[model samples]
Target: MFGAVPALLTYYWCMKMPETARYMALVARNAKQAASDVSKVMQVEIEAEEEKVDKIGTASSNSFGLFTREFAQRHGLHLLGTSVCWFLLDIAYINNLFQKDIFSAIGWLPKAETMNAIHEVYRVAMSQTIIALCGTIPRYWFTVVFIDYIDKFTIQLMGFFFMTVFMFALAIPYDHWLSNSAGFLIMYSLTFFFANFGPNATTFVVPAEIFPEKLRLNCHSISAASGKLVAIVGALGFPYAAQNKDPSKTDADYPPGNGVRNSLFLLGGINCLGIFFTFLVPECKGKSLEEITGEKEEADANDMQQASSTQTFPV
Candidate 1:
């Protein structure tokens, strides 16, 4: 309820903000409108490009639709990189988010039927809150501080690698950890910590940085949608797999281990696979958007005039 209230307020605030100047200029091709909106906010006079003129740095022929061969030849791998990483990361992420197996594993979580319904909900929320405060929140801050210095690629790779290692450690000795509640909790928290500190944050940040301004928003939208789609898969898949009986177990009470251990092994393998896809992603730190994407219209605009380069007169 506390979280929902702020989101509602923020939605209201966002609704009141004006359309961005970038969309008006690039997507709508309404330079006048974009300039007007920008100038009003900036309190400055500015010239608007005529609708038919080519953008200053880019030739008209340089542009291509996203689905065109030119785009595929140039950026298809980049798109694939973002989509694959987002998908793999979210599968692991959403499983952890939706499963809450850590609580059950630690043996501290009371079954829902054993507790008052409200108390059960409170216990779940409070347990998750502790994980968030001690593990999730700190990791996010760590990402924010080091994303530029250490770079998103390195962070995400390290995060995925560590997460894989930890999950395997937890899953392979599942029975052992179940008996050791304190160690189980520590191990569980490290996964969350690495997740936030790694690809979970980088995936969101890099998509917004590495595309041309004209197409950046669309690319990011596609990447994020891929993540959500994978989340749906995780939601449906993890629970089903967790409940499956292991074929190797004969005891009815201990039917073959529902495939939880196998799923962890799978998740770890997916993380390992994600590393290959991640290599397709460019290292975007310290580079301007144009430099990253190789579309220099905005950056080159200041240097070009009509048909000739403007020569600066030395003062």
Candidate 2:
């Protein structure tokens, strides 16, 4: 009975849809009737009511329309790259997130179990909160007041560097407290902090800035969807890894060491990979979005000119 609900809802919506005026005019070639029908359905008076009216002639001609033949391929690739990176980053980000519960499994529990979950959740939530806070406030403080102008690349690279190192560190065995399980957690926390400051925020901004105005929405959607895909992959795989991980064995037995450590390593590598990928992207600091993309065209033109200039003259 519950399964039939979806079909019933779909049928209800299907009945509400108006007939297509484009189909009627193009297929039936009855412009006068199509305009009249469209006018009533849309409640907008189309200026001219003619039997041979083209729909494209109407007031609804969208310039620079997304996914149009001219815009699709270059636009699609531009968006696809952003989308893939976002997917991988978000997957790595969120997968490690929910899997934090495995910390408890590793006997990294807090004093009171209830307080522990609350604090754990708070720490997880607040870590991002703090990073966002720092990003918003400290950026100005660091750049303006301190004269410490860290570029986008530097911040991203630092996040990647630390992520890789910590991940590798987590791969080492730490059976005893003095061996420093808590220290690993601290490093993970710090990496997460830097990620928000760097690639996590900038990657999205970079792609959106680089693509043409026509392709912005498509690029943004693809990038966002890619991030979600990464999240799903990480979420699904991390748990299986954690359950299979034998903490009793040395950390190396698992993929990156112990499950937690492995997770850190995965995140660290992914973060750094995201940084490396940023190099392929055109850097757009201090420039208008138009200028950023325009530079690429200008660069290509220059290369063509240089090639032409280098051609050997007939002897």
Candidate 3:
């Protein structure tokens, strides 16, 4: 598990690595420094783009360091709220997948010799494959659109609320021949659907918005690590909880579907808690990435003005 986690963390670190000279010039407030960082990382010399520097270097204002400012107090609260929401979302989302038996949950599968058990396992494995095919891959599109057009906080909250409704549907028993089948599809669809549009996307976006430049990368990494911590704890414990039937009990006591159902209920409660927490984040969409970083535009303007003045005069 530790090995797998570092592999995952490596992917995120790469994604968040310093990339653009544009971000660097604005964040570092020094064309020379920005060009140096870019050249080092990109493995090529970059001429200082003098016209592009914002002068104040406030573009990089996003950092975990901002929490100390009076102005940052409100955003700090939002970050804290979003962090909790992210933690719960990770727990529930992963627990649902674990319940599906993709992780080889301990003692859950029937003995290899039982044809019925083998058939059931194969059916579920195939069904889950089809579900991932239809539901998981296309989510990128919805995330791009919603993160751009919708209120991010509201979308995340709605995703959790709707998940609760799907859980309620699963908890109820219906008489129709296809009722359980329909319910499962609806529930799974909702799960993946929101994954694209809600907390899954928002959690990543929020840290980028709220922090100042110097601390942004480190804090975002920490936030991601925290979420993963929640997921790891659940992953380790859920299988044992789901499959361990009392040795003395009759065969009927531990039904095949019972563990999955219980796991869903556990996730449903976490989703509810997540919705309540979403209210804390500020609406940061439409703000320039620099402004979100907490850079002062006026300071940037003044610095540029002085630089221009310096250029006009004799040395």
Candidate 4:
């Protein structure tokens, strides 16, 4: 019920929003509506260029389907970069799934068995709130402020690198942190900080900006879906994988396994993989959508006039 409120609000706002001018003009071939939408948003008069839209649409190169050889040659590396980076990003879902165990191990939160249900809920909520306040929320704003200045590729690479560093710092010396709860909390919080400030934010932005307007939504959906699929797998698998090898410490009915220390090591390795794949995604900062996706070349090849190009709002 609580989740439904935000969903309903999002749906309402999305419904009210106009389609992007590029999508309206190119894919839907509705230059008039595209011009009108852009005019309203920019608060300037703009004429529809139906003839220009038709010319661009009829270009054989721009008409390629997503799965065609042309698209493969053009954007296959991009799709692979977006999809794999998202996949690697969500592999860190293990951090969320096992956060409580990590906290208890460091003596931050009391063990679940020590508290009644209400008390357990209170402690868990408080701990999560602290992590969010100290780590998550601040980093989101950091991305918003620095994304343009630093660029997406640099931020993501830096983020994944630091997250990898912190994960190993926590795991490699797991016993040392157990004795220093404050130090452990700081390190744990840093992981969350870099995760948000780095690939978590860029992954979403890059897919939207890098794909052609016609294929943007589909490509973004595929990238996001890959992330979500990995998240589900991490949620289900990490618990068992992180179980203590000592039978006495293992959860009821769960077999002993590599435990949280090794699990953090694995997650660190995944973040390292994210760094490698980040190279595959092109830097889209300071480039227009058309330039990034090669739509400008198609328009120029057709000898499109400046006035017609402006009317299409080739963002």
Which candidate gets the maximum lDDT versus the true structure? 4
Residue range 59-170, candidate 3, lDDT tens digits: 3333325446743563566667767877887887775545444222323344434548668688567666665665666667778765678878777877788777766555
Q: What is the TM-score ranking, best to worst?
A: 4, 1, 3, 2
- Choose 1 or 4, whichever is better by TM-score: 4
In TM-score terms, which candidate is top? 4
Clashes (backbone N, CA, C under 3 Å), per candidate, total: 3, 8, 11, 0
Candidate 4 on 174-225: residue-level lDDT in tens?
A: 9999899999889889999999999989998999999877788889999999
Error of 4 at 265 (Å): 0.5
Clashing pairs in 1: 244-258, 246-256, 246-257
lDDT of 2 at 313: 91
Reference-based lDDT, residue 186, model 4? 90
lDDT values for all models: 0.75, 0.56, 0.64, 0.88
Better of 2 and 4 by TM-score: 4
Count residue pairs with overlapping backbones in model 2. 8
The deviation in Å at residue 283 for candidate 3 is 1.8
Q: Which segments of model 4 are wrong by more than 4 Å?
A: 1-3, 301-315
Task: Tell me each candidate's TM-score.
Answer: 0.79, 0.55, 0.68, 0.92
